[model samples]
Target: MSYEMKPLEFISVKFSIGLLLGISCGWLFPIPQELAILLSTICLVITSLFFLFENYRKGIYFGIAAFLSFISLGIVAITLAQPKLSAHHYSRDYNQDNGFWILELREVLKPTNFNRRYIFQVHALNDSARSGLILGSIQKEDKISDLKVDNHLLYYGKVHPISPPLNPYQFAYDSYMESKGVYDQIYLNPENSIQLKTTGKSLKGWAAQIQLHIKKELSSTPLGVKEQGVLRAILLGQRNDLDPEVYRSYKDAGAVHILAVSGLHIGILLLIIRFFLKPLMSSYFGRSTSMIVTLLILWVYALFTGVSPSVVRAVAMFSFITYALYLKRPTSAINILALSFLAILLIQPKFLFQVGFQLSYAAVFTIGWIYPLLIRFWRPRNRFIKRLWKLFAVSLSAQLGVLPLCLYYFHQFPGAFLVSSMLIIPFLGILLGLGILLVLLASLKSLPDSLALVYNQMIRTMNELIGYIASQENFIIRQIPMDRPGLVLLSVIIILLVLSLQKKKFVYLCFLGIAIAGFQVWNLYLLHQNRQKNEVMILHQVASTAILYQNGDVLYVMTNDSMRIKTLVENFELNRRIQSTRSIPVPNSFYLGQDQWILLDSSGILPPVRKNIKGLILTQSPRIHLGRILEQSCPDRIIADGSNYADDIRRWRRSCQIYGIPFYSTAEMGALSLGQL
Candidate 1:
């Protein structure tokens, strides 16, 4: 904690921080295109001048300041250059116009049950020059699997903007798509008026084709379907074929990173190659040859895995270390980590928003920084004990880095993470080595049943162990709901606590306790606010409806179906920080302050509505004449939840439009808040 940073470490940290800050500023306040371009050019010149003129300067302090400014300016240049991302824009009337769009499929996503989706670039809109990324989905079929990246497809459809989440605190599907540069969707049924033309091969297309071939070979193996799927995920970074429960098991057990193909996998592969080629690598030249071959093989593995972010990150960091060792230079883990991050973000600034990218960097950086301190705390006499203790310390350090972010995003903690890690990690290197052997043998059609059986059994045993650990539901803590403020404080406190152990500062420990206490107090204060809330809310869910009316600490929920009550109420209950929830049947009515609500559903039961009746609630696609009802009785608004059909909601909306009545649909604008808050 009291140690000074190495010169390289300090510069790397400053560069990474400045780059992130620059990106944040650019995103928060976008400037005019011309201004951005000019500013970027100026910054680039300044940075170039700083580096070129650095030899003329003296004193370490001056050198440090000059280099920091150089990095800052370079980052500002990159941030400003992001205007180039939006250089090509969709026309204003593109969404409204419907026609035959001849587009080339640029990026093919995994196929779903009903459709195969791709991000297509529009080459021609009815032979008119136009360009933009369109999310095109063609109907799924046995033949549709032949579609490859860079294939031109003609489709007739209206491009509609992606819709927002129809529920409170639901996954922001639209925002997620936007982050990926997809704004409009063209839902097409290729069984009818769809044309497919194969274009020239692309790297991505080639990668996909190779992956498909590999998958077929693996599928033909004697291994179980789910087992092969998991192995493929481990080797090739493909998880769509994995069973949902199996994936969840790995995640809950805190061993999900095994499937992600990171530093551990790459490290294992490098070591395996080095060990096997040792006989030929006895000479000095052979050692150098081995290192060169290993590095090339690592890159090839990255290439084969479709150059995924997690894989690329690991490869980049390892590549840096390898290059340093190959050329005989001093290396630093923190510096390598910071460089990899900056390199990735410079290419695509938006990757900074990715959860995987954030967590990967955080875990690596924490392990590099804190694991050393943890090991220094206790020195084991035995080598085995040292290795075991090191593994535990590394896991703890990584978890410490990721725990706050995990709680903020997932709202749960896997208590068995350390246990699952301890059991699986020591053998992972061997498991990976065997997995590679199996793949190589299987691909070459020379796999022996005995070898295959052993590898399959290892995988099966690992899966079962992880699944058993995941099933310890009592150890898994759920619904922590740590907000941004609490998460930040908790992360800082954790760092300080570790530093306290290193520096032997009790004051740091006291500050850590105070931060925890502050988070608890803030959580309780928010709970009190929620307990005092009074309102009626209709939550939006797909084909389900739940209306909540709460007054003070009491919550009464009414839904058309009882089956989804548990899933629907979880977020609300967590928001309120209340464990008890009363699921009542659709009642005659409910009240919030002076307002009244009448429950009407598919039964078409409509109570007489007057001025005091605040809103008319519609659920389960009620069959009634809304215009006639509005004429007979006047209410403030007509509210419909997600249980109603989309067609019915549109029809009712039109009717309300004709009658000049204010209409609200949960399926359209998200959950409706009525009465008092």
Candidate 2:
């Protein structure tokens, strides 16, 4: 017997899919802002007409019109979201050279090795009022005291465009910043930067102040520093003070989400709140009041926790569910979830590209879809067994949903996630509740040392348990290779298989098999391509030089540096799907196919060659006169690796220009690739 399929209960799901497709199309194939606006207007008119005409409104025609409208709207949203398209954008109007600008510090970013960074809202340029965003970095040694959100600053500096990735398959910092509407960056000179006092404070500023106050209050307690850090992360969504080791442990244990104040935390808090409000549901007035109170608390928590995108998303989603449940209407949870997804994307379409947003929604949907299916398979009568089974089911479902994403982005999966989830999740509600209560008391200056100590011990115990799980490294899968095509195909297979299991349908199974076949074919194609690949690449490494020679399934690396770049090489191997790699010391001469290349180091010795070389590679700030070398060798191009000094490279570049020979610098133009050589 086949499971009966339910009729489409919510039209919003279809609309959401249409909107999602439209947003994806808009991103993949961007249209000009003006054209997008025009298209949107046309689509809107068509949709309006379809709805107004009684004949068209009843069938597929109306749906098509609505979908087209959403697609056009998505195009407009993305085009408009681009700050570079705006006439008043700083990059479009201002000088990149030294200029006076008024900037308000909007957000504090994680500090890098050399600098403390912040997202600054550009308020004025050359005393002209304008609006934009730019990244500002101050040297760690010149740190300004008491910097807070909404603080204004007068800066005199040169704005530079964010640099592109310096290596293939490297994370694109420029693209990431551009997505967030930050197009340029300014490095502050201490002498030219000055803080400006501002009277008006935004909600974010107030939130920061509240967090600071809480931190200060908590410092007086007997809580351990690590415990305090975890508390701040849990309650205030701040992780700047978290110990790196502890964070790594949590990540390895696949429980880092617990510290991030995402959907799981929000959901747990909601459950706690609902349990407390169960009695109020008996009366309509009480229920309504409880609903209002729950919403207020949730929103307050969202705001209090820095109003992060993830927090806001979770709150918005749960808020919808709360209202739907309280109204006593036959509402589908999937519909509510889709409505929330649609709403978020409509407001911030770029969020569709965010890893966090995708992972969160994926986990939630899988939990909702798969948990019930698992429960039906095993109905345990014992209360403890049933609770354990439910937790396992939810954990397994979430992990399955996010597995592809994790492999794609992070290239690893924690096999111990189920164990961590089973162990920690059951106590998460109590922990969150206690943390909240402790924070409130701390804010009121009434938190006792005894209570603080107890909470601190609990945190320590949790951390230890997580660390133990993470230490079982044998179960942790790392360096799993996956690409965008594989991600999509695998996702299809997972979805079809789940559907097949849920509905007991042969059609779904057939589709699942097709998806699996496609995935396998893709891998085989990649493997074949890797086997036929042959290339020479000069990598960009700071204060060092490295060159790669790839032949078929093997990679050879020649480097002057002794530093352990095993991880970097592993990443490369994963991307290439190579069988093996060999490392060797850098030699003065190398051959690519029949072409000869000569490396000139600090010694500046030019070896006598009978024939003209293919290229002259510069390394270690070679002191040889480039004009002489050009006159002597007359190679096709000059290449400088990262080991060369900037002044020397500039001098060589000028010489190359003078001689009309092509020059490549790994530092500026990224890794030089001699394709298929």
Candidate 3:
């Protein structure tokens, strides 16, 4: 029994165990039980086949089987230990009042102006009503003074189930939470809530305390609000305080990921460790000690940064690499990454759907596999040039890998990311290093005022440079619609093409190129089909409501409110390419202007008169009377705004009956389109 074979066998067994455990855990959720059973069966079959096919070597097979069995037991134990059924049941039913809930507070999501909002994991909560636990956007307004993590208080509030936002491209808050295994929303009422004190401490609470300490220390530094905020966000994951403009600057510069502690930050930390331990690396024991210390510090930093999935993934992968180095064993970066992924999935399988998780892995995988291959082909002469080229290659590789996922999630791609990353990546490393140094110095009581001043100056200089780069007009940022699945297919094809190039497989490359071209053609066909289809879109409105009707190239908006008109025109691009523009009047207006026809006020109008009308559409309540007028006119069809008809189906039905008209509500019929009569 060879040692190499032992590890290989162990890995195979572990893989089978993981698969079975994952399937079973998934079944505990709302996933089809039959599917889970089938998957489990398949896993068992595969494991059996591996054992049967591989020659039975006593020591090797036994060792491998034992290792696998242990791994499997651990996975199953963890899965069983998880509050899977409770969370799963809670996610489905929203009406519950168990009077208690438990969740890991993840991030202070976004501040709703002066009313701050925080997003955290509701790991588990009690539902007294037994309508399952709800997970969504929990809006709880608190006095700015009393907000802190792990500070449990009893409060009552209405729970609203979080769903996808009304707009297609809008943020899917529900989906985002679902990725974190949250399926309900709680909006805590500020007035009637009484704080029920609980004395408890958590690792997150300690991390929050450390963050607060660091923030206080940073405040004393002579740094501008924006600089300090950016530094804090990069170092401590405290993005709540970041200035909108400063944040935009980083986004525009394609350096937004720098603010989020990730692989880049970990890389910087690793570099610092290497520099500090250069002398100690001479001895085996010294090197081992250095590696352990570095791994511990890195994980501590991850904890301080709230242990976000991205940060955890970065730490886990890097730790594996460090361990491999310490053991004087060659480790494949991709294999380490796969192991990290398996570990994360074992903890929280829901992250498989998170955009952050997807993007993080995609970027790392690209850098690990594609970057080296790219550098091989396009090798530069000068050392500095080569470094710059590698940076460009890294950025390009990441962008290519993540392009489809980004488009699927955000529906927009920053065209300037490549150019921005070139300038931002190296400088970002410098900033993170300096920021960490400042934090360490601030922790020491003997730190001088000059140290603070220097830190402030450096941050200010970095901001200025960032600002200048952002201000450049050449940094093109365009928002392209990413609804076409064919575009995603095209992206996949591009990745395949790039991969094929590494093997010098011209035939595969050619096939990939053809597939890409075919995808583009298919995309164009879909877009043309969409353009041809007559569409009546009822837009989601906050300030005011608007409805759009499109026939061929013609666009007809039935709202006179300028704000609503402007919002629709700006946000949805109602008139992107076509020039045909027309407006229909509200019920009160009498005169027909241009292509716009006004519906006469039916307050005193004769009902028996039948006039040929194209279409009858109701806006708000005042237009309901127009149904009688519409009845008299005998319009082809009737359409009513659903927003105005909230829970008034009986009234709507009565009106439809009286008018003898076929009725359609905008809410029931998502987007209605009427073609030429």
Candidate 4:
């Protein structure tokens, strides 16, 4: 029997899309609270009016009312998701101020390469009571274990807003943190910061404590650090201990999701649980009890994983499925998927902006909708062949779903994803099953050394296999140009094509073909637009100076660093889709159209900066008297690149200030993008 979708299957999906769009609008073009309130009220009134018209059965007005209802719903969602804190909630005086403040540690962050970070709530700021999420970083010390979530701390710190990207095409670290409700950061001295013994008696705190204990136990095991890290990631969703090289291996091998506890991980765990409770599966009451036990375990697992976006989505999906079975209610995968997504967004609307959240839903939802179609296209006689085909179908479906997003965000494609998934997933699933068992036994202090040894060696073997796969450069395609518009257009095409395939309609196929042609034309048009650009950019890089001059699709780069300038040029090339970048040595002067770029170096002498020399590029910490240079030859602006000393830049800034010459600091203002000369 074909599984027919329910009538309201798309309702939640529709509302969720609108809700996200509303959130995006509010975030991108934030309005004042008063203005937002007014807009919400206006939408509400219009929606009410439309409802009245529909009630009167006024001549196909129901269609208009339905459309207006979605609009009003989106606006209302925006109003609800708006941050309660005002634009200036944090006192301006606290921007650079450092003082003794009490902070309640709320969440433990995965330690990065630099330091151990945490999300702390401000209890008292310099003796004044205040509230907000603060990104707290503790210097890595031997006593890192003492810093636990829920422990109140008194510390001296400086408040700083998260800095934007220092380079082009880089990840927006500030926006990513903001989406998770973090605004300010505090750099705390781990030794001096006094941790208060008093801890909050909360579920999150308890979960964290348990997690810490498991981590502590894992640290004592005989397993190697890399093995331990992989096991921890697969078992507990903690990957801070993972080596950078190992992480890269997994990413390139297309197995990074296995390290993150998402739908796949949870599904595997549920299967393991069901297997363990096989004796109870024969009876009704026993099955119900086992189902309840499975749900509790899933939630506990979610908590263990820090209740992250992926964890919450996975658990939510499993909850709907498990309960549907228990209640003997009809369940549609698409409807369940929609319901879970809508539920999560309603609670935390900002998750809509998260990449993990998008990927998790997209992958699972696509498998739900597309796998059946792919499975039916081919039939295998043997049961094992059938199972393998199902796996292939699922992988292909998910890959197709997330392909656009992957390209847009990561700018890479895993050509070996199919081979890797087919060859490694079954083994990885079994390994994870064993890993979960070991973690529990290890936590209980009853793990066997022999078992640990075998597990460790197996993990080593798996890592080697993944590394070998990644080493095959042919399978890892990088540097795909996919920006915002490209992502949207590709997604639309995917959706329409999928629909066409399901319906098998000639009109839909024709529309799909037209869309494909239109998208290709749009890409070519964009390339043409970029081909006419002529400009220069002073990039900000610590201890390095790189200048990019773009003429049409071709680029010219000048840098003083002896090292390869591939990274810098690659970032620019991918973002701008440049045709070629040529690195040149620092020249005496460069010309762009009729304008001139005069260079200032370590000579400590001011050259004759004439009227035609309209720009000054400062590098190598020149000791020249900038005030005197302004009098001798006044350029339109003095551009300071990152190669100069900070002290020198400060002095130059002051000199420019006195002479009324505009000093553009790439360090402060990000990469300087100048218009066509």
The candidate maximizing TM-score is 2
Question: What's each prediction's TM-score?
Answer: 0.91, 0.95, 0.78, 0.90
Q: Could you tell me the TM-score of candidate 2?
A: 0.95
lDDT tens digits, residue span 589-660, model 4: 777777777888888765555554687888888878788777777688898888789898899899898888
Q: Write the per-residue lDDT of candidate 1 for residues 1-677, one digit (tens) a residue.
A: 22222424466677777678766666667665566566656665655565566563444555555455544444454444442244445553355766877878777676787877778877777667666777877676535455666778777767887888665666676777766566778776645246566757877777777777778887778888888888888888888788888999998888888887887788678777767778766776976786788789888888787777678777877776666555655556777677777777777777777787778878888888888787878999999999999999989989988998899888889999999999998898888778877888887888888887778888899999999999999878988877788888888888777777767788988888888798788877888887888877888766777878776667788776667756657777766766567877767566665677786788898765554477788888889998887777666788888888999999999988998889998877888877575
lDDT against the true structure, per candidate, is: 0.75, 0.86, 0.61, 0.78
Rank all candidate structures by their lDDT, best first, as comma-separated numbers. 2, 4, 1, 3
lDDT of 2: 0.86
Q: Comparing 2 and 4 by TM-score, which wins? A: 2
Better of 1 and 2 by TM-score: 2
Q: After superposition, how far is residue 313 of candidate 4 from its true place, in Å?
A: 2.0
The better candidate by TM-score, 3 or 4, is 4
Between candidates 1 and 4, name the one with more favorable lDDT.
4
In lDDT terms, how accurate is model 4?
0.78
Question: lDDT per residue, candidate 2, 544-636, as tens digits?
Answer: 888888888899988876464555567678999878889888888877778888988889897666469999989899777789889978899
- Clash pairs detected, candidate 4: none
Off by over 4 Å in 3: 1-42, 45-49, 52-88, 91-107, 113-115, 119-145, 378-381, 411-415, 443-449, 553-677
